[model samples]
Every structure is written in C-alpha cells, then in structure tokens.
Target: MDISIHRPESLSGSLREAWHRAADESPGYANPFLSPEFAAGIGGFRGGARVAVLSEGTEAVGFFPYERTSLGVGRAVGLGLSDCQALVHRPGVTWDAQELLRACGLSVFEFDHLVEEQKPFDRYVTGTFASPVVDLKTGEGGYAQWLRGAYPGLARTTLKKERRLGRDLGEVRFVFDERDPAMLRTLMQWKSAQYRRTSRMDRFARPWIVNVVEHLFRVREEHFTGVLSVVYAGDRPVAAHFGPRSRTVFAAWFTAYDPELSYYSPGLIMHLRMAEAAGREGVRVMDLGRGEKEYKDWLKTRELRVGEGFVSRSHPVATAHRLWRRPVRGLRNTVLAHPRLREPADRLLKTVGALRTSGGTGSGRERSGRADPARTGSDRAGPHAR
Candidate 1:
C-alpha cells in the first residue's frame, strides 16, 4: 500500500470523489464525520489537519483523516468532536496499523469512538464501548406511528409533556431543519451555560470552535449536511440540536434546552421531535455516538460497537505520549463506570469549574458548540452529543 498525505483541501476532486464513494459503499464508513467535507471543515480551522490517501498502483482505495502535532503525535481529525473515527476505505483494502502510522510519519495516533469495522487497527484497541443509535423506520402513518410503536411509554410521556408545555408555555411546535442563525446562537448560549452549570469545559470559549460550527451550519451536501433541529413553545425556543446528517445517517451532536424549562423535559421532547423529523426526511439511522445514558437507552433501537485506543509506530515520542495520555483516559473510564467514584469526581470537577467560572479563568474553552471526549462527556440533562 502506498500512503500519500495532503491537507484535506489539497485532496483533488478525483481523490475526494473516490473517498466519498468509499464511504457510501460501506455501512461502517457512512458516518457524516467520515465525509471529506467534515475533514476539510476541520482543516480550515485546525492547521494540523491532514488526510492520508492510500493507493494501489494508480487507484485510490482508502482515506485516513487525522491531525499531527509538531512533536509527531497524531489524533483522529476533530478527535473530541467526531463521534465516529476510522480509516475510511473500500471493502478488502487493508493496511498494517503500525505501517500506516509510520507512513504518515506519526509517532502515535490516538482515537476514541472508532468504528468497530476498522479491522486494520483492531489489534490496537484497548477497549470497546456502546454507541447508541436509533434505527429509524417509517410505518403506515409515518414517523409518529413508528415512534409510538417502538417506544410507546416514552412517546406517551414526552407527548404529554409537549402538550403541558404548550398549554402552559404556548403552542409547542418543532422545526425539523431550522435555518435561523440566531437560534443557533441561542442554542450555543444555552449549551455554554449548561456546561458552566455542570462544571465542564465550555467549548464555545474557543473562538475557532464557534467559527467552525457556524461554517458547518451552512454546509448542505448529499453526503453530509449540517442540521439544526429546534423545538419551540410559541415564540420561545424550548430546545434545539445541531448535528451533521449524511444521506442515510444523522449524528446526534450538540443538543441543549432552556434550563428554566427543565421541568418540562424539553430536551427529551426535542430529540424525539428531531428523530421523527429526521425519519421523515429519509434518514434511516440516528447515531447517538458513544457514552452511556438513560435517555440513550430509552431512544435507541440498537447499539453499535466502537473502540478506543492508541496506535503507535514504536518510538520514544509514542511511549511518552501513551504514558501521559493513557492514565487520563483510564481515570475517566474508571470514574464513569462506578457511580460511587463518579459522583465524587463530578463534585470535584464541578467545584473546580465553579471556582474557574467565578474567578473568570476557565478551562479556556467554551462549553458549547464543541464536541466532548467522544460524545460530549456528560450525563446530559436529557442527552449530549458530539
């Protein structure tokens, strides 16, 4: 296998076409995050972003999008933001993980939420996690009918809340694909506040992240389109979600709601609305990404397996990187796995975050409009997505 590296934008039209074709041909690579457009979007803001094209003779066969630091440590492109990570390739095209890292001059390549079908890097995976997803299906009366049948209890409860919200707040209505930029800003503000309240890093604090999100909101393509779904009560926006949608799949990304209306369960209402609306729009699957949550359990029809690991080319830099990074991830997973440990950890983070916010010195990144470790590392009000 011949590996050639280029900036995401530097990939020629033919190479991009081939990449898209490869993604389209496999269920594993069909994630919107795997789209070349997404890589280019990341490249536009992240100077380190690059794509490695794998070829046989003169034929392009695979694409690996990643970010390489000057020290030679590499990560999957939009690592924290991308819910799905992989070396997207056509069926039957494979390469050795260490060789691939060596070819790209990467001392180490780290990833989380990697698609389970990535066989080439299978051996490197340290652990696997469940990524919840809704297998959207239409019935006789459409999404509403399908939803009622699939999740009757959830449907009954949420619809009841919607009605109560409407009766108390105003007419509850959902816009499947809202195009208003102001509402997007509102979503961010609410999301940022949610982060602050939870004692998490606010992603919107980073200017580049805001710019990238705004840029993505305008992107409309067959392979990937940025979708912002909103739920409103009268003139007030109750909840909103913004994420990318490929031809067949919609990734559940950033979702937030009016915290004051928390009693109404607007977040749950919003996702249900988005799912129904998305199903109506011809989307077949809604990938909820990784991380565990009760809402995910209630909403998902099935689960996709994803892996997390580090791939290295055997070097001092790789060893150093692993030593520094693996412990952090291990600590995080340990806390998340046990509620007794998790509660205290969360309290400590919240205390730190409270101090940071109060002192006007934060994690330096805005909490909203940015992806979290895998799927926005939080047991969300209702949900969180990257």
Candidate 2:
C-alpha cells in the first residue's frame, strides 16, 4: 500500500465523498469527530488540518484526519477538549504507526478519550480509563428489563412516578428531532443557567463551542452528524438533548430539562426516547461519555475504558514532561480517589464555585441562592462537554 497526504481547502464535494466512503469502509465505521466537516468547523483555530490517505494503487483504503501543532505535536481534528474517537481509518489496514507519526511531524501525540478499538497504537498507550455506556438496542423495553434486574427498587419507584406524571399531565409525549430552534436555544439557556447556578464553567459562553454545535446540527451524514431531540408535554418543551450520532452509536453529549418539570423526570424520559430512536435507526450503543451515573449504570450493559494521556517519541523534553506530569496527577488522583475525602472536597468545590459565580465577591445570600442546596455529587461533566 502507498500512503499520500492532502490538505483540502474545504469539506465539500469530492473531499466529503472520500470521507464518507472511507467512513463507511471503516470497521466500526465513522466517528463524528472524524468527519471532515466537523474537523473543518473546529480545526480552523489549530492551523490548517490535513487528511492522510492510505491507498493501494488506484484505491483509497484509509483516511486519517489530524491537526498539526507546534513543538512537533498533533491531535485528532476537532479534538479540542472533546470526548470521542480519534484517528479514524480502515480497520484492517496496516501501516507503520511510527512512520505515520514521523510523516505527520509529531514528536508526541496527546489524547484524552481515545476510542477503545484502535489497535495500531495500543502498544504506545500507557493507561486506560472506563467510559460507561448504555445499550438501547432493546429499546424502552430492553432498558426497563436492565433497570429492573439491576436496581429493582429504584426502577419500580421511578416507574410509579412516571405513571403519576402521566396522570398529572395530559399525556407524556416524546419526540425525536422535534426540529425546533427555539427548543435548542431554550436547552442552551437552561444548561448555561445550570452551570452558573452550580458554579461551573459556562460552555455556551464560548464562541467556538456554539459555532461547532450549530454547524453540526446542519450537517447530515449516514453515520456521523449531530442530532437534537426534544420531549414535550402538550405544547411545552420539557426536556431536550444535543449530541453526535453515528450509525451504531448515539454519543450522549449535553442534556437539560425544565426545572419546573423535574417531578416528571424529563431528563430520564428524554434518554429513553433517545435510545428508542437510536435503536429504530439501527444504532447499537449509546455512549454516555464518562464517569459514574446512576442512570448510566441502570441503562448500560457494559463499559469501555478510555482516557487522555500522553505518548512521547524520543523527545527528551516531552518525555520529562510526561514523567513529571503522571506522578503528580497520580498523587492528586490518589487523594480524590478516596471515598471519604470526596464529600468534603466536593462541598469545598461547590462553595468555591458558588463564590466565583456570584460576581467573584458576594455575601452569604448571594452565594447561598446560587448554590444548589440539594446538590449531592460533584458535576463530573468533563472539559470535553464544553
């Protein structure tokens, strides 16, 4: 096989065609982040991105999209703090990993949430982390079965509440692709409000993030694109979700619901609908991102470990940085890993976040009002979501 590289001007026509073809030919198929449009939308800030094509004679066999960075480093295009797959290419195609690295002029490549099935670089990876997932292929029925078997009491109670919600409201209706821009705007508003109220970083405040999400919404491909779904009661939008969808995976990204409708568990209902829609669309997995959540555990059939760490080539500075960074990170992780210290640490963080949120200088009332009194756990929403 011969390998060639191209720097495409735009993700239109032939480039898109090549991307889609390679995506379809991939073993696990295309990841949204691997799509040229996604890369182009977000990669503008990282200098010009390039496409690496591996071909045999006249046929293209593999495609790798990447952004070259200074100091001899490269990252998957559109990876800027996002959690998903990287280095998408044909499954069985074999190339010298080191050669590719050299060709890309990268001394070290860093990734936070690399996909689990990427085998060529397995030896270069240092560690792995678990990302929980929900299998929605069974649809709502399958989810109910899993929940009943895993947490019988919680499942029963939630079901009873669901029934009560139906009784209180006229009828609970779930809609996938409600196609309301107003609904998406509302969801972003609520999500931003939740962030401020909880002393978390506001994602919608970022221009790049807003642009990327809006761009993804308009992008439609067979396996890789953004999907926005909303659930409603009567004419009022109760809950909504925004995420990237592939043929076999619906990566659960951002979600928010009406606080007034909290009693109805709108968020959970939205999840159920998302799963059902995914199954109907022939999707098999609903990647709930990372961290441990009761809902994820309830709906998930299995988990995959993935995380961001660094891999250094022969660069001494990069090697030293990796060595120093890991031990310090390990020590910090050790402290945070303790179950007992978690609560107090979380409370302290909440307090700090509350302070930051309330003008960065506030009296008790300002802080108290912004702080969620019922908040039980740390918001594990990672940097990728932003």
Candidate 3:
C-alpha cells in the first residue's frame, strides 16, 4: 500500500469529507475534537494547523489534524488543554508511525492525551493519567442507582448540599441549553477571572480561543454539540457551564460560578443537573476531564486512562531536539510529582491571583487577559506542516 499525505488548501469541504469518512469507518470514532471542523474552528491560530490525509492510492484511509510548531514539533490540534483523542484513522490501516511523521515532515509529534488505539505510536508515549467519567445510559435513575451503590456517602453529601442550597437560596433552578449568548459571555468573563486569580493562562483571553469557543457553541451535530447549562438562584444566574456533548458523552470543559453563591455549591449542583440532563438526552458518559479535583471523585463512577508522549521519526535533528528537551521536561515533571511543593506553589498562585484580582499589574495578567484578534485564522503556509 502506498501512503501519501495531503495537506489540504482549505479545511472547509474536502477536509470535512475526509474526516466524516474516517469517523464513520473507525470504532470509538465520535470525538468532536478530532473532527476537521473542530480543528479548523479552534486551531485557527498559533501557526502550523493543517489537515494530513493518508491515502492508499486514491482512497483516504486516515486523517491527522495537527499543528506544527518550532523544535521541529507537531502537536495534536488543541493540544495544551483539549481532552480528546489524537489522530482519526481507519481500523485496518498498516502504516509505520515513523513513516507518517516523515511524510508530514515532523520531527517530533507531541500528544498530551493520545488514544490507546493508535498502536504504532504508543511506544513513543509516556506518562499516564486517569480521566473520570459518569455513566449516563440509564438516565438519572440509572446514575442515581449507581451513585447509591458506589459512593453512598458522597451522594448523600451532594443531596444534602442540594437541599441546603435550596433552603438558603429560597429556590434553586437549573436551565439546560440556556441559549443566551450573554450567559456565555458571562461565563467567559468569570473563567478568565478565575484563570488570572490562579496565575494560569486564560484561554478565553486568546482571540482564536474565544472565536473557536463561540463557533463551537453554535455548532450542533449528532456527535458534537456544545452545552451551556446555567444554575439559577431565584432569577439570578449563579453558575454556568459550557461543555461539549455527543450522543453518548457529555465532556465537562469549562465552568464558573458566582462567589456569592459559594455556600450553595452552585457549581456542583449544576454538574449534578448536567449528569441528569445528559442521561435524559441518551448520553451515557459524562467525562470530567483530567486533573484531580474533589468533585470528580464525588461524581465519577469509573476512571479511564489516557497517556501523553512524543513520537519522532529517525531524523537526527528530531532525535537531538527530543534529547535536548528531555532534561528540562524531566525537571518540570519531577516538580509536579512532588507533594511537598504544593503549598508553596499554591501560595505563589494565590499571590499572583491576588495581583490579577487587584487590577492586572504584571505580564502574567496582561498575557492572560488579552489575545490578538487578527491571528484568529489558520496559518498553513509555513515551514511547520500539520
């Protein structure tokens, strides 16, 4: 089989067609983030966003939506924070991962949450993390049953909290599919504020990110839909969650709540409502993406492991680059692995957060609050090929 790569000129028609074909033919193929529309929509900036079509003769067998970067690097579309699979490929294709890298002119391909199905590329990956999920197939009743059977104490606590919240707030209401754009704007503002407070990068501050999120909010498909659920206290919106939803999965992406309603745990209440709504919509899973949050443990029924690693072709430059980055990567990872440093890190973050809260004095806040609007388009005509 001869495998040739096609870097499409435009991601509109041809790219979507290829992605549809691959998705239909592939198992567990319902990842919205892997779709061409998603890549083009969200991966419109920061250079090196491209669609790679792998064909055996004339028929396309695989599609890889990637972003090329410096250090001869290639990353999965929406790499830094995206909680989805990498590379949408057909089931029976036999191609060397290295060959594909060479064909794409990539030195190193970095994936944070690489899927397990890409067997050829598994060898290059390291680091393992668990993604928590709630089974929603049985609807609210089913999940409720599981909750009682699995984490009775947590479920009781949540129910107690819900009651307390209602009692304290007068009346608690949940609105699913809140189509108000104002709500989204509010959520972005709150999320941005939270990011700054935490000394982290605010994704919504980036024009491309903001554009992509807004576009995705309007995108409605069987496999990929953005959900904006709001929890209300009386007539006031207290919490909002903007996440991606598929037929069987509701992926929790971004969420924010009013600090005034912190005593009510509006965020947790919203999540509970989200799970119930997902079950009603025939969604069987609510994926609370990576990271260890107490809420995830409280709501999750099981955990799925996803990995991160780098794949490189036998190019000398690529290998050298990988070797060079290894030590730095190791040091960072080591620091992250230690529990003792958490307090200091938290203190630093709190300090930065305080500064950001105080009214943006440093570069961190500046970088996090503003994103160039002009760079909200795909940059394909560059040395870095997707």
Candidate 4:
C-alpha cells in the first residue's frame, strides 16, 4: 500500500471520486459523516484537516481524514461533530496503523466512533459502544407498516402523544426537509438551552461549530445532504432536528424541542415522523449513533458497534498523548457504563452547569459529541429523553 497525505481542499477530483467509491462499497461507510463533502466542509474551517490516501499501484483505494494539532495529537476529522469515523477503504484493502500514522506525520491518532470493521485499529480500541439504527427497507407495505409492526407500543404511544399535541396546540404537521433558515436558528437556540439546562456542554456556543452547521444546512448533495426536519402544531414549531444524510443513511445529529411544549414529547414525535418520511425518500438506515438511551432501545431495529481509542506509533509523543487522554476517557466510560456512577456524576455536572449558567460565562464543554446524536449519555441521549 502507498500512502499520501493532502488537505481536503487540495484533493483532486479523482481522489474525491475514489473517496465516494470507497464509501459506497463499504458496508457501514455510507454514513454522511464519512463522506468527502463533510470532510471538505470541515477542512474549509479547520486548517489542520488532512486525509491520508491509500493507493494500490497508483489507484486511490482509501481515505482517512483527520485533524492534527501542533502537539502532534491527531483526531478523527470533525471528531466531536461526526457520528461515524473510519479509514474508508474499498473492499479487500487494509493498511498498518503505525505506517499510516507515519505517512500522515502524526504521533497519535485518536477516535471515539471508529467503525467496527477497522481491524487494523481494533487492537488499540479500549471499548466498544452500541450504535443503534433504524432499518427502513421500503416494501409493498412500505416503512409505515414495518414501523407499526416492529414498535407497536412506541408507535401507539407516540401517535397518541402527537394527537394530543395536535389537540392542545393545533393540527400537528411535519416537514421532512424544511428550508427556512429561521427554523435552523431556532433549533440551535433550543439545543443551546438544553445543553445548559442538562449541564451538558453546549456545542453551539463555539463559533466554528456554529458556522459549520450553518454552512452545511445549505448543502444538498448526492452523498451528503443536510436535513432539517420539524414538527409543528399549527403555526408553532414545537420540535426540530438537523442532521446529514447520505443516499442510504440519515445520521441523527442535532435534535431539540421547544421546552414550553415538552409536556407532549415533541422530540420523540419528530423522530418518528422523520423515520417515516426518510423511508419514503429512499433512506435505508437512520443511524442513531453510539450511546445508551432508553428511547434508542425502544425505537431501533438493531444495534451496530462503534469503538473508542487511540492509534499510535511507538514514540514518546505517542506514549505521552495516550497517557494524557486515556484516563479522561476511562473516567467518562466508567460513569456511562454504570448507572450507579452515572447518576451522581450527572447530578454534579448539572450542579456545575447550573453554576456556569448563572454566571453567564460558561467555559466547560464536552470534548466529544458535536450535536446531540441522542440526548442521553454525554451525546446519543444516554437515558435523557428530549
């Protein structure tokens, strides 16, 4: 295998095509987060963004997009923002992680949502988490019939709540692809407040992240399209979600609901509506991403595993990087893995978050989780609903 590194912007058309081809052929790589458009979008803002192209006899066969800090610490591209991470490669191709790192000029490469098929980096993974998905295979009866049969309880409860929402507010309606930019702004604001209220880190507070979301909202592509789905009761927008969709997969990224209407569970209603609409539009999977959440368990057809760890070469910088990062991740994983530990930690963080909110100059932010993949755990809504 021949490895070559280049900035996302500098990549030629051939490289972009190869990147898409790799994603298309790979089983789980069709996620929009792993697409070239997301990489390029992130690359435009993040100067450190780079991709390591793996070639076999002069034909590009793989792409590993990442960002490197001055300290030589590397992370999956849009590490916190992206729900999926991988060295997107064509079938039957593999590379040595250490050599791949050397070619990219990085001492350590860290990732939280690495795809499970990445055997090259499997040894480095400390843990794997469940990433839930909604399988939407439209048939004679279509997605609606599949959902009603699979999640009878959930469907009944959600539909009942939606009906009540309609009665209380107005006639409930949904838009699978909302175009209004104001609705986008409304979602960010609601999400920002949710973050503060829960003591979770507010990602929208970051200027770059804000700009990135806004930029992506306007992008409509074959491999990557920003989807903003909303649920309205008459004229009021009660719930909204913003995420990217590849041709076959719609990643559940940022979702927020109007707290004033929380009594009706608008967020849940929005997701149910989204799944139905997405299926009609040709999306095969709704990637809920990796994290534990009661709602995910209730709604998903099955689970896919995602990994978290650091891939490094045998160097001092690599060792030091791992030493500094692993413990922090370990602490988080421990808390999340156990309900006993997670509860108190959550209370403490909420207390801290409350204090920060009162002060109005909050500095604490979760290191990972771009938008709310789920509203539970830190991201992927642990047990937290809406």
Candidate 5:
C-alpha cells in the first residue's frame, strides 16, 4: 500500500470518482459526511484540511480526510460539526495506523464519531456511544400515514398538535426540500438564538462555519446534497431544518423553530415531515447523530455505535495531546451518561443562559428561545457538545 497526502481541492477528477465508487460499495461509508464533496467543502474554508489517498499500483482504494495543526497534531475534518467520520475505503483494503500517521506527517489523530467498522484504528478506541437513526419506509401513504404506522404512541399527540397549529395559525404546510436561501438564514439565526439561550457555544457566531453552511447549501450532487426543510403556517415560517444527505442516508443537523410557537411543537413537526419526505425521495435512513435526547428515543428505530479516542505514534506531541483532551471528554461523558449528574448540570447551564440572555439586547423571544415555558423537554434539539 502507498499513501500520499494532497489538499482536498487538488484531487484529480478521476481520484474523486474513485472515492465516490468506494463509498457506494461500502455500506459503512455512505454517510454524507464521508463524501468527497463534504471534505472539499470543509477544505474550502479550513486551511488545514487535507485528504490522504491510499493507492495500490495505479488505483486509489482509500481516502482519509483530516485537519492538521502545527506540531503534527491532527483531527477529523469538521470534527465538532460532522456527525460521522471515517477513512472511507473499499472492502478488503487495510493499512497500518502507525504507517498511515507517518505518511500524513501526524503524531496523533483524534476523532469522536469514528465509525465502528474502522478496524485498523480499533485498538485506539477508548469508548463507544450510540447514534440513533430512523429506518424510513415509504409506500402508498404520505407523512401522516407513515408517522402513524412508525410511531403509534407519538403519532396521535403530534398529529393533534399539527391540526391545532393549522387551525389557530393557518393551513400548516411542509416543504421537504425548500430552495429558498432566506429560510436558510432564518435557520441560522434561530439556531444562534437557541445556542445562546441554552448557554452553549453559538456555532453561527463563527464566520467560517456560516460560510461553510452557505457553501454546502449550493452543493447538489448524487453523493451529497444539502437539504433545507421548512414548515410553514400560512405565509409564516414556523420551523426549519438544514442537513446533508447522501443517496441513501440523511443526517439530521441543525434544527430550530419560532420560540413563540413552541407550544405547537414545530420542531417535532419539522422532523416528522422531513423523515417522511426523505423516505419518499429514496432515503433509507435518517441519522439523528451521536447524542441522547427524549425526541431521539421516540423517533429512532435503531442505533449505530461510534467510538471516540486518539490514534498515536509514540511521540511527545501525541502523548501530550491525549493527556489534554481525554480528561475533558471523559468528564463530559460522565455527566451525560448519568441522570443524577446531568440534571444539575442542565439546570446550572439554564440559569447561566437566563442571566446571559437577560443582559443582552434582543427581542424577548430571541433572547429566551430555549427558555420558553411552552417548550418542553421533548422540544429541545440534542446538544451538539464539542
């Protein structure tokens, strides 16, 4: 096996074609996050982004995308934002972790959402967590019928809310793949407000992140496409979602709604609508990503295991990086794994959020998006912890 590193944009068209072929042939590598388009999207914004190609004779058989920092530290591309990460490769293709690291000029490679099937890096894994997903099936029925059949317990209540929402506001309508750019901006604003109100890091506050999302919104490809789904009440937008999808998989990414209309459960409505529409569009699965939440439990048909850890090559930089990051991840996992610890942590964060928002200059709804009394536990998006 021979390894060579190149900037994502520098990859030849034929090399990219081979990468897509590998993804199509491997069931485990089909997530949109693993697509070449996504890697290039990140590379366009992040200067450190690079793709390591593994070739056998004249044919490229594998691709590993990552971001490299000074002192030989490396991480999965778009680590905090990407829900899935892997060295996408064809079946029967394998490489030594140490050799790969040497070839890429890395002392350590860190990843949180590493796919379980990545056997070459299996020994580097420290912990594994569940990533919930919906197995979608479409036929004669539409969203309403599909919802009823898939989640009998949730269907009645959710459908009832949709009806009330329509009657009170206006005729509630859903667009599975909304092409409007304005709605995309609205989603970012709402997500920013949600983050601030939850006392979490506002991803949209970063210019690069905003640029990347905007760039991806324009990307339309068979292997990866940015989908923006929205729910409207008459002429008013009630909720919206923006996520990436491969040919067969849709990854649930950023989702937000009008805080004033939280009582109507717009967030839940948006997800159900997205799922049904996606299934109709030939999507076989909707990945909710690696996080635990009440909504995920209600919607997921199964869970995929993702590992987190560091792959290193006996260097001081590798050892130091592990020592610094491992404890932080460990502390966070402990809090999330147990309700006793998680509940207090949540309350503390909310208190801080309330204080922070109250002092800021914004509309009450925008300032307190996550603090709305009408928004129950079920309405919250899973925390995208860094």
Candidate 6:
C-alpha cells in the first residue's frame, strides 16, 4: 500500500533483487523488457526513465518502470522499443492504479503492450491484441530433431532451403550469441534499409535508440541479456536478429536479413535457429511480439493477449493526450486487424517508399539489398513478418 518513485539507476541492489524475484515468481513478468536492467539501460539515454516501488512495511513487493514527460504525462519505459510492459509484483500484491499515478506524480500513464494479468488496470484497457509466442523445449534430441517431429512440413521445407543456401553459397552456420560489434552495425544497416524500402519509421535513425541497443549488447546479466543471432552462409552473414532475453523468456525484437537472399527465406531460418538456441540456453518462451504475421502463425505454440490503453485522472493534460494519441492507434489497429485494408495500405507504403528511394541522395546501388517485392505482404524487414 506504500509507493515510492526513484530514478532507475538509484534503486538499491536489494530492490533490484526483489524485482528479479518478482519476475521469477510470475509467468508473464519473466520478459526481459520488464527487468530493472532494461529500465536502467533506457534510462541512460532517456532522461524520463523511472521506477515506482510499492512496499508493505519493510518489504518491496512491486516495480513499475515508466517514462514521464515534463507535462506529467507518462508512458511505459521504451514504449516503441519494448515488446512487453507491466507492474511486476509479488504474488497476491495489489495496488490502486490511480493511487500509483498520484504517487508517481503523473496525470496519465499510457501503454501499448500491457500484460493481461494487470487486473488493477483492467478497466482502463481499451483493446486487447494477440501476441504470439513460441514455447521452446530442448527435446531428447537436438533442435533439428525436435523441429522435424513438431512441425514436419515446415521443418522439411526450411531445412531444404537452408541446404540449398549452403550449397550455393558456402556453409550455413548459426551463431546463437555473436559478440562481434560489427555484426550489430550490419543488423542496424539492413534494418534501416528495410525501413526505408517499406516506408516505415526508421528507428535506427535515432541516435538514442542506437545507443540503447549498443549499451544493451554489452550487458550480460541473469535478468536481461542482449542476444544477437546470425545466420551465416560461407562466411557471409545472411540473416541476423537482435533482442533481449531474461532467464526464462527471449523477446523477438529487431530482425533483418540480406535482401539479396530473400528468396531463401533467411528470416524464417533465423527465427527457427534462435528458438532452438534459446531453449538450450534456459529460455522457456520466445516472445514473437504483438503483430499478425504468417511466420508467427507457423512458429507460435500459442498466443498471449496484450492491452493498449491510457490510465488517467481527471486532468486536462490527460484528456488532451488521449485525444491526440488514441485515434492514431485506433486507425493502426484497424488496419492491422483486417487484411483487406492492410494489403492496400502496404502497397501504398511501398509506392511511397519507391518514390522516396528514387529521389533520395543515397545512390541506388547502396540500397541494393532492399526492394524485394516478394516481401511486401510478408515479414520482409521484421515489422510484421506476415
């Protein structure tokens, strides 16, 4: 019933230990994005980063990480970058959302990927969407053996393509945790090109996000570790993925492949390899994130629900923030929910992308790895790997 707010880096070691214990005790809270380390990483680049600790007597029972604007409007920490958000708490611990807001000195708090078990914030939820996940298990045999048994058809096709890729290139090898910093740069470059080609927001263009990824890459901890997996062919990187992992969960965040090798379905190969390696590394779930995509359907064992909404008090700032942000989110959700509308929107984006590419200063040759029409409706650059 007692709440205290502090800068993420200022949290005592004991408080972080309690936070980790809370994550271990709860199923959904196990995601790396909810970890104190992740919050601190974001806090390093984002000045608004903070954590709200809820306590009963001497024991800290809950942790809520968020970013607040000067206007007192707040949002989940790393909102656009984090795939999971929650008020991680010990079992049976509960607090009022409004009280927590007041304690944090916020007029409103908004989130897009709120955990489903947040009963206190249930009334504030406006919509719930399916977030796909792959439950991984290191079978009696290895990854290949398990894949064949679990998804015979998919394994057959994917494995065959991987073989072809190897034969044409050199050897196809997968690195579960690549340490080279250059590989990280390669991923960002490919992802940037992919964004430009698809006409989506280029997240890598922002220096802070770039810095955040680099900072996280060097972090090796029990609760949050940045994992960069690469699929290489004949010493050439064909596909790569960068995401964060906790003890039990690995979130699928940024993934990109050599566009020239799109015909071989390198992105699919990357996901399958990452899942296998994650299972061996003690990860129980590979969160594919919230989105509708064909690759997700083929790989997911089940789906978890995530909410998007605003929790607010009767303040003009809260009302104004809702009015401005809600409609944009509503339109995006509507487009993503219906394929009939989504297809056209995608086409228009590609068209705009083409125009931009033609007029841009970068040489056409530099963008060679992009412009794959086959990836238009599917998971080309990792946004919606449909």
Deviation in Å, model 6, residue 167 alpha carbon: 1.2
Candidate 1 vs. truth: CA RMSD? 4.7
Candidate 1 Cα errors over 4 Å, as ranges? 142-144, 347-386
- How high is the lDDT of residue 196 in model 6? 83
> Which candidate has the top score in TM-score?
5
Clashing pairs in 4: 374-380, 374-381, 375-381, 376-381, 376-382, 377-382
lDDT for each residue of candidate 3 in 1-386, tens digit (9 for 90 to 100): 45444443365465567677778676456656666656666555545776677777777777777777665678777776477766687778767888778767788887766766778887887777776778764523554564565456757765676677667775677788888999999988876766666666667777887877888888787667888999886678877888787656677777777655555555666777777767777777787766554567677889877777788877777777678767765654565555566447645765877866774532222121221111100000001100
Candidate 2 at 340: error in angstroms? 3.5
The global Cα lDDT (0 to 1) of model 5 is 0.85
Residue 25 CA error for candidate 1 (Å)?
1.4
Model 1 clash pairs are 202-365, 202-366, 202-367, 203-366, 203-367, 204-366, 205-366
lDDT of 1 by residue, 147-180 (tens): 6887797777666767888999899888988999
> Where does model 2 exceed 4 Å of error?
1-15, 25-27, 44-48, 138-155, 163-170, 316-338, 355-386
Better of 1 and 2 by TM-score: 1
Compute each candidate's TM-score over C-alphas.
Answer: 0.91, 0.80, 0.82, 0.91, 0.94, 0.93
lDDT of 4 by residue, 1-386 (tens): 89988898789989999999988888679999998889988998899999999999989999999999987889999988888899999999979999998888899999988888999999999888888999975644744465576567766766677788888889988999999999999999988887887667678888888888998998998999999999899999988999999999998888887766666767667777788888889999998877776677767999998888999888899999888988988877887789899778767876876676775644333322222222442244342222
Q: Write model 5 residue lDDT over 1-386, tens digit each, in one string.
A: 99999999678899999999999999989999999999999999999999999999999999999999978999999988898999999899988999999999999999989999899999999999999899998957667888888778878888898899899999999998899999999989887886777677888999999999999999999899999999999999998888999999999888888877877778778888888899999999999888777678778999999999999999999999999999988888888889899878877776777788885644234232223211222223332442
Query: Which window of 10 residues has the lowest lDDT sum in candidate 6?
Result: 363-372
CA-lDDT, candidates in order? 0.81, 0.63, 0.66, 0.81, 0.85, 0.85
Q: Order of candidates by TM-score, top first?
A: 5, 6, 1, 4, 3, 2
- The 10 consecutive residues of candidate 1 with the worst lDDT sum are 374-383
TM-score of 2: 0.80
Ranking by lDDT: 5, 6, 4, 1, 3, 2
The collision pairs in model 3 are 136-284
